[model samples]
Target chain A: MNLQVVYCNHQTAELDIRERLAFATSDQLSNAYEYLRSHFPQTELVLLSTCNRVELYTAQESQDDAPSHQDIAHFFSDFHEIPLTDFFDDLLERTGPDAVRHLFQVVSSVDSMVLGEPQIVSQVKEAYRTATEYEACGPLTHALFQGAIRVSSRVRTETGLTEGRVSIASVAVGEFGKSIFDRFDDKTVLVIGAGEMAEETLRYLSNEGVRRINIVNRSPDRARALAERWPGAQVHAYEKLEELLVGADVIVSTTGSEKPIVSVGQFSRIRRNHLDKPVFILDLGAPRDFEPGIGQIDDGVFLYDIDDLETTCEQNRIARGTEVERALEIIDDETDRFMREIYHRATGPIVKRLREQWHDISQTEVRSLKSKLGHLGNDDLKAIERSMERLVNKLLHPPLEALKDEAREGTPHGLLDALKRLFHIKD
Target chain B: MVNVNVICFLASYSVVLIMELMRLLGRSPVRRTIMLLFGTAGFAAHTLYLMNRSNQANLPPLLSSSHDWLLVLAWISILMYLFLTTIDRNLAIGLFVIPLVLFLIAAAYFVSDSSMPVLNVSNLRDAQQAALRRWVMLHASLLVFGIAGVIVGLVLSLMYLVQHRRLKHKQTMQRGLRLPSLAVLSRWNWWAVIISVPLLTLGLATGFGVAFLSDEAVPVSMADPVIMIYGVAWAVMAAFFAWLLTTRRPAGKQVAWMTIWAFGFLLVTLVGLQVLAGSGLDSFHAGGTRDSSGLV
Candidate 1:
């Protein structure tokens, strides 16, 4: 059996290249699986697409049948309508033990942008499930994915990598929100958009006892939906955002608009209405939702944008990197151990078949000797059978030991072939 | 049983405070155990010392002389510290409380050690003298408890500030220095202010009542150094309490800082007045022998 992973991740590719090559939707992923199955009919396929990386993991009974790095890149190029020349150099490939180790690292979040994030494991599980639903996974793919999940769980339990603030929302609230307000229950939380970042931030705030949550989005239905999901939260149209801002103690803006949603003048008016109560504004938008000057309005107004949280997240990332290394080491060791076990399991049947055939030949020879020499009694014949069996076992021990030892590195295919030929053992 | 002295407990607490400070550097289970043992030993010694003083004075520690009175206040604070620290081994209360205990004991050195004249329950005692003694005990007890509350307020405010800073910086709780949540600390601070102010007002009122009841002796006048300074400290705390209650949006940090300033002023004035009064200053004398009545 063979396992392989061909992909480019945050480590190997720039963000722009990854974004261009990424399968961003479930439809795209399903189509990619179709293309993979069409190209390599015998190979099992599971495609993992996240913001940080895009990896295609495939397994097969023979290495030759497994899709190559070029095949996967061409599939991406054809599926996404991107030129092969654009990302061909950025693509990286791992096979055999390396591929298994890479998958283990990915599932364990060792390969994630935020080390120890729990989201990646679930994402991997979803990818595997999707592949299975598409009839793309076989026994090798199933076992590999299951092993990856188990390894991820073990790594999380055994290491301290998951102990601290490992998410953007957690860092934002912890670093900025707590600095602005003493208690969240007494504060009004205004979520500006219904994006995932907003949802994540709201989740953290709600956990901190924020009773009053207001969602203001351009899409009122989405806003209403998000607000309805969380208890005690209310949804408002985007037009009432300024009025909501006046009452909010914490404002989290993550709208996808290209320009600033709230300007200094608008916030200044809101600040006047609210008096000098400290308001924590977390602008999680890319192009900046709240104007830069809003942060400078007064001492009571504290504004933290994506860039500010980025610095803190980076610091935390650095601080936790040592633990990440430790976790990665654990994954590496476990991957090697798992691969060795799989190799041993693969070689087991052939080894058993060879041993049985040799033993049968020895038994027949012992019977012929006992029958030809009538001087031997029943006890003596039994003694000869035991002696012949011991000779056959001793003679077979060296090559079997060598094959098992070679299995540690990988499947000892060459040695097994030689054993089958020499022992005249049929498949 | 070996007789535990003030020095034995004072030294033990001092060592414990130092050990608590060491936790800021790093955590060690051995160090924590040692700190707990020393704290318990100090508390035992403090209790023994108060018991001895109460026994000698033939009065409750709160009704004894100003020296023993202040020690009683310190003893109460130490009890609170020990109770809280024992329950939450991670609390850094010892760092804030032990110093106050040390200051109380240190301030005791300058105050009068002579027991206040006991109120005679027998018929031979003068009505006015008995009345004066009872009023004095009441005044001292109220003031002790009031000051104890102030000490608690001060510590809670300090804790609020520390917790606020840590939360603001997004630092994880240090291994041995767990603090109360902001909500809990704020609630406790509010209670401390609410309770302390009334007790302090009563203590002041009782002081005035005692002065008025004693007609034969010159009453404690407003001009008296101790009385004047204490009044000023009370006014400061009263103003702080007013702001605390009146302001709808005062930050916890602001409240904490105000409490620190006001309570800190009261402590300094209370201790300073006692020390100044002990120097036999004629400016503080009311009607009794300057050597006999002042401070003690």
Candidate 2:
């Protein structure tokens, strides 16, 4: 038996090449599965296509039937209608244990662009499910994907890989924003600018169930465009910033202004009546949209700038990095155990057949001896039958031991063939 | 069949407090489980000890004696701590609550263990004694509940201060030390004060009413040191509660500080007077003589 994977990821290929190679839609993935099945009928296949990677895994019952790296490259070239010269060098392949380990790492999110992300496991599951729907998955691929899922779950539970938020926006909203307010559904969210980080923070806050969002930006068109993406979000004139800030329970500021937008004097005036009410301010701007003194204005005004969040993000990054080593160790151990199970599965039938055949011969001889020795007592006959069984086990031990040792390295086809001919074992 | 005593549960709680402290280092599931085990063991022993004391005094634990009263308060605190910790494994409530429990139990050791003489119904006739006993039970129950609220308010305020400090400094929440948001803590603390003061006020009113109606030639009076001290504590708490109600947009940190002071003074006065009364100081609620005050 053979296992293999042909893939290109963010680490190996540029985005342009990866985009050209990715199967963006389910219909495209189905067509690719159909094309691979037609081209290589004896092989099992699963295709995983995400924004960061495009991977194709194949398994075959015999080593000779598996597709080579160049064959898969040609298939990609012909299927995606790209010349082989364009992406052939970027595509990489792994076979046997290496292929199994790569799949484990990918499912565990160790190979993700964002380390410790939880999406890759579900993506891998979806890819396997799609392959099964297309009838492209077989026993070897089934065991491989199932084992990968189990290993991923183990790594998640046993390690702190997914403990803290790593991104600046996530840390701002999840780490600090969540700790200040119990619920966000009733709170008003004010977005000061249309910067990318501000949009990301808005997304995080929106997911936390912020219903009312007010976006105020220098450019009305950009603010309108940002408002359209999330439901219930309204665009406002920049002059209404103070009015909006007065009502907002959560504020995300990412304007590109050269200086602070809301200074101590301005915020203090707005905060006069709302001193007791808590307001979370995430100032993601580089030049500090909210002044540093504003956080100290009152107990309820929680103002966090980029520097504050980056420190937390860096700490989270370091924590996640430490857990990566532990996750990799788990993945490596799981891979070896999976490969050993596969090898044992390949040699199982022959071992069972050899034992059964030897036991049958010993039973037949015992029956003949019992019939011939009619004067022997029942106890003596039982003892003689046990001796015959022991003799058969002794004679079968050496060949079985050799086959067992050979199965450890891989499937022992050479030893199996020799045993079949020498012992007259049938298919 | 085994003997249960104050020392048994006190040692168990001490161990549990040490385990709760270890949480500051980091989170460990095994350690949390063991801490809970110790806490549960201590609570069970405490319950048994209270039951034994009630049986010995031939009364309910709440009205038995000063020692039993203090232990009952500690018992209630442990019950809350165990319940909260069980519901949310990550809450650092035990760090604040268990120390107060330990303090209450330690205070129980120094105070009077003898039953209140005025509440001893065996020496008096059936009808009037029954009325006095019922009033005393009401007084003790109200006082115990009010103090329990004070304990809750103290813990919540402490949590608010710590959470406020961590947020102001922009430090990430420590592992195993997760607290509720400041809003939740502050709101709960406000309720704690608002509810406890009224209960305490009614408790004091009932105590005075029972004292005046007593059939003794010399009824308990305002001049009694214990009653005077309790009156002063109640006044302070009432003043704080009135300020709390009237103030619009009171800062959470300010409220937290005020709650700590008001509740802290009341707790010290309540426990300190009892200890002094136990050490043979002349007061209305002291144990031993039949002429002593009956009200808690």
Computed on alpha carbons, the lDDT of every model, listed in order, comes to 0.80, 0.89
Which numbered prediction scores highest in TM-score against the true structure? Answer: 2
The local lDDT score (0 to 100) that residue B103 gets in candidate 1 is: 90
* Residue-by-residue lDDT tens digits, candidate 2, A88-132: 889999998999999999999899988888889999999999999
DockQ, per model, reads: 0.08, 0.47
lDDT of 1 by residue, A1-427 (tens): 8888889988889999999888888788878887888899999999999989998998887777877788888898988889999889888889888999999988998877778788999999999999999999998888889999999987776655654465578977765566445579888889999999999898999888999998899999889889888999998878888788888888999999999999999888878755547678889999999999987776567677887777667665665576677688888888888888789878998889988898889988987897799998899989988999899999889988999888987988888788889878787
Q: Which segments of candidate 2 are over 4 A away from where they belong?
A: A40-42, A95-98, A138-143, A332-351, A376-427, B3-19, B22-24, B48-60, B63-65, B118-121, B126-138, B202-222, B246-249, B283-296
TM accuracy, model 2: 0.87
Every candidate's fraction of true contacts kept comes to 0.06, 0.57
Pairs clashing within candidate 1:
none
List iRMS (one decimal) for every candidate. Answer: 5.4, 1.8
